[model samples]
Target: MTLTEEFDQSLLPGELILLESAKLFGATNISPNAKQWEYTRKFPIDELRQAIQRGFGSIELPQIFGGPGFSFGTKMRIAEELSKFDLAFTFALIQHHNALVRVAELSPSDHSRELIASMLTGDLIGCTAMSEPEAGSDFSSLKTVAKKVAGGWILNGKKGWITNATDANVCLTYAQTDTSLGSKGIACFVVLGDKEGFIRQAGYELHGAHAAGVGGYGLVDYFVPDALVLYAPGLAFKTALQGVNRARIHVTAMNAGMLESSLSIATQYGENRRAFGKSILEFQGLAWSLANVATSLEAMRSLAYRGARQIMRGEDALDSAAIAKKFGNEQTLSGVAACMQAMGANGLRAEYPLARHLAAAKLLSYTDGTVEMMNERISGAVKKRYVL
Candidate 1:
């Protein structure tokens, strides 16, 4: 049976519909089905083109903007299932909307229409142009600059670790308005991918997300018109983290999906193979390890759904969302490892899903917000109650 068929029978009907829709959209460009993201490292433009043709690019925009206006719940469901298939592909799709949120929140209505139209028609792709090589976690240390000029602005300095690099149609970028204001001096800019002097530099041949084919940009006097600005000077960085938190939660759900995929594959292998004169599941130790995976996965789903519901209700789930993200990523990794061990050496083989699941957990856990950052956020919440 196809995975979608299995999904329909296993997931709730509503969830099944969402997954089927995403699948039909070809929103995922991850290759090898059960293995790794092959196209990204090499820039699988052909498959990506097919995905765009399938409407993968416009999944979340408002209908008037050529998007589906899907609820956060629906998005979370799609992200989780897509991550089960391919994390890099899921990451690529989410970056576009993450970039769009700035436009949605601040762009002039006309600019909004233009950008949203491009997004819907697959004429525009986007990348987040934050994160210099030196300013990993300490965003305050970011040094890219944007200087105002007549009728426009001049962007200078390098943007390191860009996911889509120079190939994207646009970049949701942040730059320093004035060094005197430091991190708070940061202003957001919407720069076109084809802008002059905006060069994508070498690097980002990564240890993971290989299909991402990541790189960076060296912005040398790239002039972006004031017409292209998404947020007013210094506004985006102030609110930048809210978007990051949302992405973190989405990434957590993706990790949960990957782990879920691996666990099912592992369990099937365990049941089929004989170990010590019986299936590995027959061993009490192995059985209990499998039980841990089940319990942890259930917990992950509960927390993720709670976070999604809380967000939909406009509740403050920042701390709780981080907790869910951290919990799901951590537990999923532990479970994948356990399942791998239960499968013996065969689990380490590329054909098995657990290996890729472990890699995916590592990627998501570190990418959106580090687990340590999540802990600090949680600690702040605790401290706010005078319990730190």
Candidate 2:
């Protein structure tokens, strides 16, 4: 049996159906053109719009808001299935879905009613901007400033490493209303991309994963009316923290998916390819290497689901999420590389997804949170959780 079939038996029947649907969606819509999108550095806007029709645009939005409102565990499963095909494209979809949830749940009813509708229909794409040129992991150090003015606030700053930046028309932007108050001074605003002062900057040329549309933009005196504020000072930072656990778990699932894909490819090649007058799988060395990756992949899957379940149950998941992300990041990077090494020269070929998966594994290590940041979180809780 395939790795997914063996590993996913723990899922509920309904969740399995959704996962199968996501698998089919990725195979039909994303897998075929993922290489081309990477080669040409295109964002696959049309395909993402098609994904919205398939119910991928609003995975976490409430049913009242016209979304599937699936549990957090189910959403992570779907994310794993999609990421098996392509991490960059899957990440873009996740970002868009997250933005939809943020707006529907946080924005004022009268202000977001129409905006949410357009987003669901894919007429308007969305993204969140938190990291700036000078601040990423240390978000409190962000220099983006928002000054209060008549009728609205004027924002000025540049956001970098944002997903869907090139095509997004609606942005959830965070700016400091007062630097002295640090994180407490941060505020979130709905900044329309078409506004006069919103500047779309050129995208970054990464080594791979270009379908993410990772880019940056500048907000030059961008005016956001009082009605557009999602979180005023003293509340925005806490709101952002509330979502970090979910984000970390989602990224862990993606890492597991990528590792699964790479291992499957390498295993298939080892079983079929012949060397020294026998199948390469006959070689004890190569076989054990692949076996190690398989074991770690299962462990990563378990950690991902554990964190997801905690969030679903409304339990404290900060430590679980950090541990899962930290383990997944370290394992996936090494695991994908081990899979590639098992394939020899064939692994480097563009025809296989191994190369792309490897690059994506490295890129994902920094997403959601970095390994160092995860370590800090886990280390802080070690004495409290372990001593008892």
Candidate 3:
């Protein structure tokens, strides 16, 4: 069997089906011409539509809600496989779960059922609005306000660096319902993209993950119905932290997959290219560097797998997830850079995956949280073990 197949069989029966769905999605979305697409930032939307049509977006909700209701292990596995090709595509599609889960958390059973059904069938492309112009990482200090009105709440603030911002039909926004409560006063609301007082704009030029179509949105005192309120004040912070931690794990896996791609390219180059009348693989310097890259790749993958398993086991994986993100992103950038060096000028050229992978890995180091943030989280956890 293929490597993917072997990995699939290692998972539970439910996980196998999700993996199948992901494999099908990957086959349709990931281009053999990935370099061309990366350079151009023009993805094949029809392929995305095809995957969604096959129910790729709604595999996590329960059957009672018309969702496949796959386990966390399955979700992680599916993300790993899909991100192996292109993280941008995965980012664009996973919004369904993020949005629907929030709906389930804040809304009643009937609303959850209806929203989840729509989420799976491509009718509800959703996004989270947490990062404002001033509150990218420090969500507690956000100035966005949600004030009570006659039939709904009025929203006023700007959201920056949002993924799937333009494409999403709905956005689950977080705004401070009461400034008196500080972070504890924050609350979540469901805002339609075309709602009154909502203004959308393009974001600044991003380096990598450009295909994700990130943008900015301005809520010029937008109004959402009282029915649209998601989680109340106290719950917003809890869910934001949880979602970010979960996203960190996925970022770890994406880095792992990108590192593997880079190493594969480097090894193939070493085996085929020759210098000084000998193959590069036979040269001690190139061989040793390749060895280091391979070792680092395995180590990062090991860490990410542990984090994924922790998520699978239904345990709190925040600290472990942060560690995995820290190590995986650092290792991926270093490994890809080394691979580029091994390839000489060819690696620098756009024809190679090394350049694109290196860029992508660098960007990932800061996406969910920076390496510095991960270090802080890990250090704090360590301090809890004993007085230092």
State each model's CA lDDT, in order: 0.71, 0.89, 0.75
Lowest-lDDT window of 10 residues in candidate 1? 2-11
lDDT of 1 by residue, 1-388 (tens): 6332332353455545656767655433453642435423555445554555555554555665566555666667777877777676667666765665455554456866787667555567778877887776777678888899999899988877777663676787888888888777888888776768878775466655654546778788989888777767567676777767677667767877877777888889989999579887898888889899988887787777777767767787788888898898789879889989988999988766567667767777777678888889888888998963
What TM-score, to 2 decimals, does candidate 1 have?
0.89
Tens-digit lDDT string for candidate 3 (1-388): 6333444555777658667867766856574645555667754455555566676666666675666676655666676677667667676666656676667655565655666566566666678888887887677888889988899788899888777776665788889988889989999888878768878786446666665667778888788877778878898888788888778887777787777777787889878998899898898988899899888877776676677677767889989999999998888888989898888888888666567777778878877888999999999999997767
Give the better candidate number (1 or 3) by TM-score.
3
- When summed lDDT is taken over every stretch of 10 residues in candidate 3, the lowest stretch is 1-10
Candidate ordering by lDDT (highest first) = 2, 3, 1
Supply every candidate's count of residue pairs whose N, Cα or C atoms clash at under 3 angstroms: 3, 0, 0
* lDDT (tens digit, per residue) of candidate 2 on 237-347: 998988888999989999999999999999999899999999999999989998899889988988888788788889988999999999999999999999999899999
Cα displacement (angstroms), candidate 2, residue 278, comes to 0.9
Better TM-score candidate (2, 3): 2
Off by over 4 Å in 1: 1-18, 23-40, 104-112, 386-388
